[model samples]
Target: MEQKIEKLSTVKIQKSPDVYKVVDALNRTLKEDDLMFGLALDEDKEKMVFTIYRT
Candidate 1:
């Protein structure tokens, strides 16, 4: 179960309540493709940072 995750791209998005849902869905749907999604909060600007990774 050793995997190397590499950051592909990242973008700042407007905060959304369903962000977690989106990330979960992506992880489930794309796991077979070696793709992972992550979400981070930028509290200072009240924004969501979405990052894509390849394993």
Candidate 2:
């Protein structure tokens, strides 16, 4: 069997209001598309970045 890797895209939210809130919203809103791949926090820049895989 052949395995394929999906392309990923990153989105940064500067001065994010709430990390958990954003994650919850994304999970809820994008559940159908299943776009969310992962999330990370940039302490230096004080930003939250989300990695989404192309579907």
Question: Which residue pairs in model 1 clash with each other?
Answer: none
Please tell me which predicted candidate would have the highest TM-score against the true structure. Answer: 1
Candidate 1 has an lDDT of 0.94
Which lDDT tens digits does candidate 1 get at residues 1-55?
8878899999999999998998999999999999999999987769999999999
Reference-based TM-score, model 2: 0.49
| 1-55 per-residue lDDT for model 2 (tens digits) | 8745475777787756667677778877885884656677877678877777645
Off by over 4 Å in 1: 43-45
Query: What TM-score, to 2 decimals, does candidate 1 have?
Result: 0.87
Q: Judging by lDDT against the true structure, name the best candidate.
A: 1
Error of model 1, residue 4, in angstroms: 1.7
Q: Rate the local accuracy (lDDT) of all candidates.
A: 0.94, 0.70
Clashing pairs for model 2 are none
Question: What TM-scores do the predictions have?
Answer: 0.87, 0.49
Error (Å) of candidate 1 at residue 8 is 0.4
